[model samples]
Target chain A: MFDIVIVGGGGAALVAAIEAATLGKSVLVLSKHYPTQSQTSMAQGGINAALYPPDSCDSHIQDTLKAGVGLAKEAIVQEVCRAAPKAIEWLDSIGMPFSRKGEAIAQRRLGGATYPRACYAQDYTGLKLLHTLYDNAVKLGVALRSRTFLLNIIEEDGVCKGVSVLDMARGKVEQILAKAVILATGGYAKMYGALSTNGFGSFGEGVAAAMRAGAKLSDLEFVQFHPTALKKSSILISEAARGAGARLIDQEGQEIGGELWTRDRLSRAIFEAMEEGREIFLDMRHLGKEFIEKNLPQERKLALLYEGVDPLKEPVPIRPVAHYTMGGIDVDENMQSSIQGLYAVGECTNAKLHGANRLGGNSLLELVVLGKKAAQSAAQMEQAPQQKLFERTKIDTNFIKAVFALPNQIDFWERQEFLSKIMYHNCGIVREEMRLKGVLSVVRQHQKELAFMGVRDKSPLMNKELINFLEYGNMVELAEAVLVGAIQRTESRGAHFRADYPQRDDKKFLAHTMIWKENGVLCADFKPV
Target chain B: MKIKIKRFHPHFEPPSIDMEYEVDNAPTLLDALLQIKRQKDRTLTFDYMCRSGVCGSCAVRVEGKEVLACQHIPKDGEYIEPLSVVDVIRDLSVRLEDALVTLGSSKAYPLDMQKVAMNEEDERLIERQSDCILCSGCLSSCPVYESNEAFLGPFALSRVWRYVADKREQAKKEHIDAVVQNGIWDCTLCGNCTQVCPQGIDPKNDIVMLQSKAVQFGYQNPNLGGFGSFGLEF
Candidate 1:
């Protein structure tokens, strides 16, 4: 039995593990795959912190609240902002090679920052930070159990117990008795098929597990779709590109002006252009060939050296992809969920800071800041008695096999491609009531089709079959929650723009959307932001 | 155009199967596979991303070695299939995700940047290697990875070297000691990582630097050392 069992490995889990170890708690990190594979490694932009002289906690809070379009909780935003600086200092203390502007830490301007307050270690800031944090945490003796997927959270008598983790390497399920648990399993953006830049493991297992364990997931409807992901591949081009003066242009090379415009506006514009038979490219031309050659030389190299395109001369095709999810496991200002001794952080939880749309550098910032808070709180909580309990879940091999044998085994890819097209056409960027309802109906049909998915390989250890099966489940739930939330919200704010509503209606829908799973059915509730 | 793809699976005969594809001028090699899946054989599978190549997905063996299918231009008579050695997922998409496992497993010195003041040169040296996108390209190209599954591949080791070389990062000795085990020592100092690197990061040079740092940390490659030597514990 351990003091804490942290499920999922990402920026939040890594930070929480570090903090827990610092506070002298015996902790185990259960990562479904290797720790760094999480979307945190994919983070290209710098972390947000009010380190610049002109920047203050108040200003940061105000910006976040305004971007959130008034749905952001005042206290949570304030707490995250106050904690932001300390998180930066901690990262700095632990050798985050933040760019320096003559003895002072150099800062870059991202979408939401009023001033240049983004501390970066070049473009691969998240990767560097994650590597640093993982190294530090391991050295401090955080027990990292890689290739361990949590089957379910074990709760007893209304209190949180340990968890049942499937030893993915050995193909055996085991119950880990622990005093507390933290879920940092990342967002559900991948549910939209091709729209997501999320890794396959990013299918919202933790959120589903938490919901299964009677934990309410808040703001499930407010998924933030990033305005730019590379076309076809859906790889995220950091908004830092826009922050560095990249523009949004149409097929005729007409500038949209507000390249750094809120993601909702940009995504809407891009989607509209596509609808009007125009291909959109996040124009990196303005950032200058020299800057692209020097700072983002690899991006140019990736284009020419790999794609054989002279990016300095030609425009790279681009599109808006489902980037980050703003809503997740509901947590308070302290990163504590309603369930005591359980905390959620990073993209896995809705801390109410990014109510609707996330600021550019703020995701990583929230990871370090509120992640530390969650860790500290979990560390301080009284250790519960060990409980030997394992939740029962059976894998139907026959069903899995039958699905694999279906004539349309590989057709799922084509279906997924179709799903992406539909999503981008209907539910993406700008949504209307008619389009949204049509999207839900299509989503249901897709979900039904996915139900017949079969696994070719039935192996228990590190089987892609099982993993894909799990991802399919996550997609179904995520699509339902997003559709429900998008349908229910009935307003325009931040990333959730409804053409039917047409305008930002602060009066009717300034609340958080909470989702719960009961009897295999999804249910929704609202909380005042 | 008639395209030949060399397919390999543990279950298949002769280790590699050469399959032919007919195509038109187009999107990508992956686009060709989708065409084949739609028209000829549905079993043909390969990994891809960003049809543009920024995501580092869709890497596969074209003629002899690993190449990102999205980036590698389609030719009239090209050989395409999954990368060699690693577990095959389907056709061209091998399960090479283990390339990043060492990043989480390695030990490094404490990150007390407040204590260490960095010079511009040191920062430049560290920045040069930190851009690895975790594509399994280097691993697919490495001969060492072909023989030894336990070997920490180029990407992870190069990244470890990236941190160890950083002036601000503490635990330089610790990082050196960390990678010298199953990490850097397992690398045969081949230039494959440098060659296949889409980002142009040289894991060979990074490994050499890591080796130098390991020496500074009073550690030696136990496998390479002639005399009985002791391993340093941080």
Candidate 2:
């Protein structure tokens, strides 16, 4: 059995693999797609670290806490912020050619930063770090198995024995025996469909799988809606644009916020502007074509390729899209889930680093630092007895066949489009009791249709339709969790803004909303902050 | 728009197939491809992830040109084929196992035994070289790889440029040597790879840059003319 099996191949998973491998433990990184394609590579801004002037760990923590709006855990925030500088140093040592100043790596101010602490490698900071870390992990003997999709974790007696993975290449489901399982699967913003800044694989399958294995998820409602996604495809136009002098304008050409507002404020401003029948656009023309072509090349290419707009000559159309999901599998200080030997890090777990909403640069920081902590803790663990007992879940061939042949009445595209419209309009940046309930009712009504969704092609090789159907169903459940949490927390705090209840209520709701399956029905319970 | 994909399974010739259902609003070609799978047939498969172009997973031949499906808009009669010069698995998907093998021989990742640092200004000159997503659009489109399969190809050579341009790397001779072995001289500099790159990365320029770096490193393409004072009077 492998000493550690890491599911997902993003930044956090790579870090965990490296750390685990460093401890003389055999590591396996199972990824749904190639590691380079993971959502971590989509991170355009930069990683946060108080490595330069006007920036300190304490100040960075404070900015993150303020942005989190009362839900950000003090200790966890301290953990990530304290490790930020060292994390940057480690990444640099591993050949992350950070964007530098005179002799030092350059640090710049991102949204919600009190100082210029966000370190970058041009605009593709994540890409630089991800490539280096992936290479280092491979050299360190971390076996990265691509095209392996995790079905579920096999646990018996509160200990994770291993996991069941669908080997896509072999076209068979198989068991992977491991002492520990780490879910580094990223966010579920793609649950919002075309209205999400996430890539296609960002659906939170690991979260759902962990939930099915009796792990509770915390704070699923507070999805961060980034302010500067392209209006057409919801492809992210990075916030770094605003950091480097870009402005948001409503139709008729009036500036909303000129370059330096928090994401929550900007998202609300754009949402309110759109509601007022004003089309939103990101104005970066003043930054000059040379400045853009030099620093923000990724943003320029993304604009020209995806939206067919030139940010240099013309303003790019923009709107808020669901970017990060703060809620995920609940983990402790050690990053261990409720079930023993099961760990989660990165966007897939609620490390409480980003309470209601994450700070601009802290997302990448938390992934690296907390991911390392989890690896060290797991590596230090006394090996659990290799018990023969397992909660074996037999594959029901009849049910599998029945699911394929189900009389799917509703088309998946129409259903997804309808859901995206409902979520984008109703449960989006601004939330209300009536709107959340409306979407919940719609989901409830379509439950049967979802169950009966059928696949026409019977060829089993590379059944993307089956994967889509499964993920779409999970998205519905995960979306329901969001609506449920939104309904539960009747307060405006961080990203969870309720129009009906316009004030932050710390007395009754200054806690993380934990949601899980209780008796096959969704149940929400609050845990004190 | 009727989407046509030349479907191929292992050990069989590709079959022509058109999608059944019509999608109302597909923001990109990827969305349309997904709709074809979801609304029509579950078994019709292709390799895709990160509908965003950054992932490089959804690269395919669209109307005889290599492009990222996620970035391009779908046109009617779109003929989806496995990106050329890669092993075909099934349908539009290609077995990418051997796709990036040339990168290792090119020493794409720095071969530094010790950690090194370079100034940000120095890195800025070659930073664009790092953005090659290895979508293999360049490799698939390159006439060098199409003819001489052993050629180091476009993306890998571009990566060598990314490293050779780096002032931090003390020892880059291995990278230069690897490129020469893989026939750095084999590239035609036709610019097909540059046209096909979704990220706007210029592999042709990078390859030429590597050639310059190779000359600076006391190596010259063996395919070039007589070294004996034939063209130059010293």
Q: Estimate the lDDT of model 2.
A: 0.81
In DockQ, how does model 2 score against the reference complex? 0.47
Q: What TM-score should be assigned to candidate 2?
A: 0.92
| Residues A396-458 of candidate 1: C-alpha lDDT, one tens digit per residue | 323334454555444455565576567655666778888888888877887777755554544
i-RMS values of the candidates, in order?
A: 4.8, 2.5
> Candidate 2 lDDT, tens digit per residue, A1-529?
7888899989999999999998899889999888877888888789999886667888988998888888888998998899899998887766677888887888778888888788888788877778777767755657888887777778776777778777666556677878788899898888888898888898898998888777889999888999999888788887788888888877788889746678887899889988988998988999997889878887777788677899998999988988998889999999999989899999999999999888888888988899899898878656754645343424422334565777767666578779978997888899899989999988776665776666665555666666676677777778888889989899999888899998999999888999988656888899888
The top-ranked prediction according to DockQ is: 2
**Residue lDDT tens for model 1, B90-200:** 456555445545556664335344456555556777676756656678888889878887777787788777766776666666666667767777777869889988667
Error of 1 at B42 (Å): 8.1
Each prediction's DockQ against the real complex: 0.23, 0.47
What TM-score does each prediction get for chain A alone?
Answer: 0.92, 0.97
Off by over 4 Å in 1: A164-177, A301-309, A380-391, A394-415, A445-451, A456-461, B1-114, B133-164, B169-190, B207-234
